[model samples]
Target: MQKQAKYIFLITFLIAGLVSQAQVKQDTLKREVEVTKAYTPTISDANKLNSMPEIDEEEADKPTFNYNIKSQPVFSTFSVTPLKAATIETTPPIQKGYGLVRAGLGTYYKPYGEIFFNNLNSKNTVFGIHAMHLSSFGDVKLKGGDKVDAPFMNNEVELFLKHTIQQSILSVDLTLNHDAFNYYGYPEDPVPAPLLEDEQSINYFGTKQAFTKGGVHIDLDDPGAEMDEEEFGFQLDYYYFGTKTEQRENFANLTFNMRRPLTSGVGLLDAGVEFAQVSNITLPADTAIGKTSSTILFAKPAWYIGDEKANVTLGLNAWFILQTDEETQAKLAPRINANWAPVEEILKIYAGIDGAFQHNHYSKIAYENPFVKPDHHLKNSMQQFRLYGGFDGKMSKRTTYKISGEYAINTDKPLYFMNENYYFDAAYNPAPLIVDNTFDVMYDDMNRLKLNAEILYASSKKMDLSLSVNYYSYKMDKQEEAWNLPTWDATLALGYKVTEQLSVSADIYLIGDRKALIIEESGSLIPEDLPIRKSFTLDPAFDLNLKGNYQLTNKFSVFAQLNNFGFQQYERWFGYPVQSFNALAGISYAF
Candidate 1:
């Protein structure tokens, strides 16, 4: 068996060696062959998959190996970018100082000063004090080239306090005013004075037109601006007005108003009432004339409908006006107002018909024209009816315009005229002076038609412009012409900023001619429609004003103003000529 295995192994080894040799010889030998056809390569079609793939559910064995990483900082040549930090909020802005002082001196011996004091930001309370003074002590050149002393002084002081309680606001105001002006008006042609009474004196006519006033006003309001709430308001006002001659007037008013919303706040019901009194206050108990006190009452009830885009107000005003002569005058008038905006923010139309009743208080007349005195009794004025229509709209992005017309029927319209002097000083209880150059007012029934147009433009940051024009036509019931009332008036104003620290402004004013009475005699029978007195037209008046301001520092500024630079000798009244070509320069300081 051993001998046979050895022989088989030997045979196998010999065969293997012979095969290897044969293969090497065949591969190493080079041979050439001729081909009848060229060789080509081709691929057979692949098998298609018809059924979708299915995932196996059988568990598979997972490898279990554990390794630990050494904690070390790896070295790298690449750079890393940093992230941005979070933001931080800043504080609120600082408030301005609470005091301002202004002082100036001007031509015509004018001295002007103003001061304001107020508290800084407060949570629930605000208080302020203001004082002002202006005066002119110089001569005015009349139309006939004559100079007269036309001195005037004005002073004002006011104090105000306001407080907030929950959602309501309460306010209180105290005001005082003292003013004086000399009645230096005289006709161009001097007229002869009639014989004086036993106790009359010419020097008394030189007394200044001086008056003093003090007032207190209080108000409480609940706007009810949030969440369909009711509104309520109250107002109380009282004042004392007096002249230098111990003649005085006292007035008091109390008002209450309430509003109730209806129909989900789409409409409102408004109701209010006012109680007022006017009394003549005189010392010594003997200078008083007629009734001392007069009462006035007003009841206002209205309904308001619609929203900001369109609205209508229907109301009635019941008035009870009493005269100083113990006469009662009562009237009930209708009030209606309708407003609509056809093109929101672009055009708005408003129309209204209303009437009002008010007392011709001595204080009101004195404030309107300090040079005028009353010749008749102080009565009540009534606007029987007033119809007005207007349209206001934005002309452009920075411009706005308004056009309006009004027609009114007025009774006891106050009109001023040159005093018809018959030297009737004896008729007055107090020894008085009589001057024909002085002015007096009368009451007349008038029908008036007025047309007005106004335009405004603003650049917000730099420039501003404004213009207004008015024309009036009057039909008087008893007078030959509307006395001392102009038929046309116009104003133009422009403001420009040259730089951040400098600004300039200009203004021009125009007034048309007015009529004056040219009567030679006077009597108690006045305000008649008869054409006994002749009439003449006064010259038109024009005025131009310029102003400049320069800011030197944040809290300091300088200002200069020029008034009546045209220097035209025209009268605002029949014979009174205003001062000409006045200039003022001043400095303002804030702290």
Candidate 2:
């Protein structure tokens, strides 16, 4: 009886609620109709008679049926005024402009400062400065019996400046850069044992070791060793070829570009010229030991078509390079690149061809000879060419795939000697042995082919994943001295958004079978004798962003970067040990 009563009660309550809802809806509709009628005009007899006097008799006779149709007036007491036809004068489309300036000062294990500036006006310009000071000193172990003591130092500065200008149909850019590095050591010391070992070993694969013999090793507590080495060496050791070495380099570049619209369906025509200069100064043991300079001039003309949806460009480039105290070379290079969209906007295919001839002087520093008296001025020149093509497309809203392949070749030319009859006899000989023309010495040539493919999936809200694979093969011309260094590299990353304010990311990189052969001038090639230094590394980082009304803050972040995480001590070359697990953590804030 009670249950039945409860059921009846619930049914009655639901019915009453529905009835109330229906009454409210009907009242709202009635109010809207009444408001509409209040502003409508009624067709009274007087108004009809007045309107009829102006109508023609034929029109009146055609509508003689006793029918009455009325509609509400569109304008009421609270109505907006009718707008006049406005002559909208649009300001001619002014191009957008933007600028950015950023500066950062941080103390890592060392002190670091950075400044960056960018201008996005009619012309784009960018400039940056980076300076760092290390508070602690480190040691750089060398081969043979030499060692270099690198004390924790300060006052290291590097600067870069760039400017770009854009006109209606032309653009110009310029860049300047300077770099300086400081290291501590003494002159006349035997090459460090570690470095000497590296020089002698065919492959770098081993643990790092320190050499204990040969040069004078001064204790850090020695008052003389603590003085600024540059000034101390210049003042004290003015006779024995000085006691330190310093290197400085200056670089500058300029580029000019012009574009012209074409009448045909083809894209615009483009031409450009580039100039670059590099000056390297090396001071050793008190005096300027060597200086090398290089200058290059290059020009390119190209034709381009289509838009971002699809594009094809063909171009030819020519360059002339001249090096001080070296031979000059002229090169002609051509390039072609294209992107095709076959199905409107779904799939994209791309291909490119690049080829160039490069020539440069062999470094005499490696042989410890002065610039004026190079052991052998080797005319080392090569022709390099590559062809690459790829396809990228979306399979769905959340998945994408890309695949590419490249083939490159490097071929050497005949050698030319500056001195025809130079011979090798002394340790510091300025010439190489002149052998008979029939003496067949195989030059170095390489052919490489690479293939890469990647797939990205972002189907979930909280997680995104990507997988990629790369394959490479390097082949040499001389069979006995040839090397087949086939490598496969892969990477995987996973990220988690812990909260709106913080996130963490972890990634791993794996390399496989990074082995090769090392050949010597003695006509003997060592195989598998060099260490195959391949390993997997992990990088995990976290970031926190604390929001404020008019400021942003990140309190603390940590990163653990592990190289050769497997703890395998192998070197890409002999005697030089690769870095082990190195980790750093810091906190940053900005206003």
> Pick by TM-score: which candidate is best?
1
Candidate 2 lDDT over residue span 1-591, tens digit each: 565445445434533432332211100010011110111111111001001111221211101111111010111111111211101111122232221112222222333222222232322333333333223233444332344443332332333323221111111122222222222221122432332243333111121211111111110111221111110100000000111123223333333323334443232221222222222343222335455556665545555766767777887655556666645555656678999888644578999987765533322221121211222223334456789999977776656677999888867532111111233445434543221111112246767688887765542334445666677776767543222232555655443444433433343444444332222233225654542322222122111111111112231122222223344433222222222332322222211
**Model 2: number of backbone collisions:** 25
Residue range 452-523, candidate 1, lDDT tens digits = 887766554566677778888999998878787778877676667677667776767777777876555534
Candidate 1 clash figure, as a count: 0
Candidate 1, residue 481: CA error in Å? 1.0
Q: After superposing candidate 1 on the true structure, give the runs of residues whose Cα lies further than 4 Å from its correct spot.
A: 1-95, 191-205, 223-229, 264-291, 374-376, 421-435, 522-532
Question: How much does candidate 2 score in TM-score?
Answer: 0.48
| TM-score of model number 1 | 0.76
Clashing residue pair totals per candidate (backbone < 3 A): 0, 25
Displacement of the residue 457 alpha carbon in candidate 2, Å = 4.7
Task: Give each prediction's root-mean-square deviation over alpha carbons.
Answer: 39.1, 32.4
lDDT of each: 0.60, 0.34
lDDT of 2 at 22: 26
TM-score of each: 0.76, 0.48
